[model samples]
Target: MSRTIRALAIVLGLTMLVAGCGSSSGDSASSSASSDGKFTVGFIYVGPKDDFGYNQAAYEASVAMEKAVPGVKVLQAENVPETAESEATMQNMIDKGAKVIFATSYGHYEFAKNMAEKNPGVTFVHQGGLKGDTKLDNLGTYFGTVYEPVYLAGIAAGSVTKSDKLGYVYAFPIPQTLANINAFTLGAQSVKPGIKVITIATGSWCDPSVQSQSVKTLLDQDVDVITQHQDCTKTIIEATEAAGAYSIGYHADASSLAPKGWVTGSEWNWTPLYTDIVKTVKDGTFKGSKYDGDFRVGLQTGDNPFVQSKYGSMVTDDTKALIEKAKKSFEDGGSPFAGPVEDQDGKVIYAKGKQPTYAEVETMKFFVKGVVGKIG
Candidate 1:
């Protein structure tokens, strides 16, 4: 879930928080991370901020956090790599005056952990991970159950696919991506029995050239619907649209980008959670609060930062009803992985009447029966 950045710099967004997801962080006015009695919050993304995908969602929420929490200024660095450079960038933020750092990439957790130990004053929260090294209260991880909405989108994809071939272009077989793929396969199978999901794992998250080739590979296989788990998602979605294949979006609302092909999606709504976390930090209550450890949210938890996108015109009323009913099951303690689920080899993974817990699902390793891809 990371990619290379062409131009990397810590651009301080001191802009007054504006309305909508198209938030203009005031001006490109650069300043110290914190000045004029402002509490500074730092965020780093592995891709460009306006990529219409993952970074954009986080960027928008960062601006909202600044506005929602009083006396806060947001400092963001786009196209940050998952290398030692990430650590240095964070250290630079700390050197300036960042009190809270949102390491918003899976690859940044280790680096964030190291920095958390060194700078106990600055609280570090990693995205999509658990609290592994919890000796210090300064380091924690948090994420919404993103796979939940992906399953709903899969239902839409399954309903719309004429060829019964759904393609998935993913970055890597990380557990998070694996959970999304498996949930999507399971959701599709629930409605369209025998629907096959052809998968192409492009090792890079935002390599446009590789993504184009992967899209070509999936389309060549006669796939009628496409979805992905890459960092920068515009290329694959646009390519699929041009090829006349239905596209299920992820990470952000890209329905506008694929007007003809858009069929619902899973995207982050991090404003609520980001605001809550930043508020706690501003009040000096984050140390021993619920945000001090691994915090997971979903429909069952009253709110999930990841929610289903708007339904496309191709989605039928019956399919929307199915999605609503399926989502209700989750809210009622049912799961997308409620078994009898089978692995690729038809091995019974979860028995009937049983399902993996939220935490257990995070450690997912194998593809489900309908996924036409290898785990390694």
Candidate 2:
């Protein structure tokens, strides 16, 4: 589709563009963010900036990049749902002279992909979404080895879990979340044999009422520790703490909210990567740049952009040592889902001495052997 045609569709859809600090108001005044002038970058989020979860981390990174790059401006629109509204937001930013756009939600990929095709002059990068067969120069996906820290947190969960049952409250059965749940389960199993993890899918990234009910169900099942792959996590963590269960977090730290039941969690530090992308785009090097494809950083890459939080008081020094040892191994090129891994049906998945590549891991479709849930 042509850019002009797409713009007309957006206008007819009556989609609204949020105007904020550093934002545009649908006026066609020439953009300072043009390639030759003051570069402007746009970021659209799927939730409130202060959710203290996924969006918060991305929002903070956007602000950091804005400051890191001198003479560059940033446009931010929060609370952007994953629907066609996202397409409108992209068009608005493009009109405002944004040469690079960060679509910071998984569900935003389709719209971002469409926009990337329509606007070859602009660069679009997405977070946590897999790159499809369309090999566009201006489109890419980037993420950290998020499952690495989750595995570390799982070690803590396993160390302290009294009933050998760890509960996972996740957004979906997608490979990324599946990898986290599998890593968490495997990490716990490494510490405590015969450990079992119960999995429940909330299906929505930031639903509180559904998360609260999942916690109650897990608590009733005598699960002692709970962790999640959800976006807005306060409801689940707070619910877990209220029920006297240990909680592990994702996206951002909720340690303050679960003082008594808090375990160490994983968080995003996107400065290095985000800044690098902005610089590349601003320099007109984004087309053939390293960020031009499925860019993933892990321990071996030296900075995964995701790391573990400080350990809770309940974690033992011995457990911390073990986590560090595993981390070192990962830095030396070990994977959480290493060889000898099996599916829930006892069928071998990754045979001994054979490992799954990052590509294989990204398409993960089965529950690990000890997980107690169905993935469809």
Candidate 3:
């Protein structure tokens, strides 16, 4: 989920049947020991394995795990939709000897939790979810607070925009997307006041055509800088190159996609978390715990690997200096959403000049002062 420099949940309540009251010790005993010699891990994707976006990053981590660990067997199912299919698919993997299961979709949370119960011995992990009380001791949830990097990208896009009007092509109106949009707008306004971030949601994660249309529509309306949360870079590359505008990419390093028009992006680096989990399991110290793929553990430059590629020498030294300063601040534990937020409908979500609390930022559901367009 890339575009120019413009900008841009929890339910708990569930339980593992095998985790408590109704579980049979026989089932739990069977799960505790693996008859297979190899470490078998399975992953399910919400999109294609090679979408060049979010799924790609997860796939890359899985691939690295395969190479790093000896006697490891990796299994993956791609193009999995967010429906009943998730539960069935996960069950099939678990039945097929998967010791560690990574369900990599927001919609797969319930399925992963349920499947974790049926297979109490197997460790189940999901991305983009909160741990519920009824959750299996083996089930874990995680998501990256990459909005911090997205904010930095917005600063770059804001500096590059000549019209001060930016475009954001988004996918879905979920809390995650909304937070990114708000953070991007705030980051831009921090650098360039009175800047407006116009947003458009395509209701899809990996539709290139929809993303392309979203970008074209925004560019046609005279937006000079663009950023997106969709899954492809083709649209951003095309729009910015055609309109001679600047853009910041998302999900992956997209400077190569628009060498002449692109700035930096907020890409996911899932290696650190993946590596740590794998190491934990290998060392027999696996506690079946929850993992937070947030700024504290997942967005590391060395391990999580978000990058800001140069905009083909188009970036002035002053601009570079500002970005470097922001980067340093972020590295020093400053928050991108440290303030005064609002929703898409202009409601005072966080109040004037007050930084949003941690819970408020994670549960954000609105646009900021200058983000134009509907939340859809």
Q: TM-score, each model? A: 0.86, 0.87, 0.81
lDDT per residue as tens, model 2, 112-139: 9999999999999999887866789999
How well is each residue in 1-376 modelled by candidate 1, as lDDT tens digits? 1232322221223222223223322222236646577888889887668877777899898998888887888888876777777888888888778899998987888899899999999999888768854687888888998888999999999999999999999988988889999999988988988999999999887799999889999999999999999988889999999998899999888899899999999988899998888888878899888888888887887579999999889899999999999999899878899999999999999999999987899998999998999987
Clashing pairs in 2: none
Could you give candidate 3's per-residue lDDT for residues 1-376 as a string of tens digits? 1233222201111245334443221122123223567787888887767878888989998889888877777777776667776777766666767778888888888888888778888887788776646635677776666677777778877888888888988878877788889778888888887899989888776677777777778888889888888777766667677777777877877776676787767777777677777666656556643342222332333343444544545667787778778777766666676545556566766655566544566676667788887763
Clash numbers, per candidate:
1, 0, 16
Where does candidate 1 stray beyond 4 Å?
Answer: 1-30, 33-35
Best by TM-score: 2
RMSD of each: 7.9, 6.4, 11.9
Which TM-score value belongs to model 2? 0.87
Give all candidates' CA lDDT scores: 0.86, 0.87, 0.71
Q: How are the candidates ranked when ordered by lDDT, highest leading?
A: 2, 1, 3
Among all windows of ten consecutive residues in candidate 2, which has the lowest summed lDDT? 21-30
Error of 1 at 219 (Å): 3.2
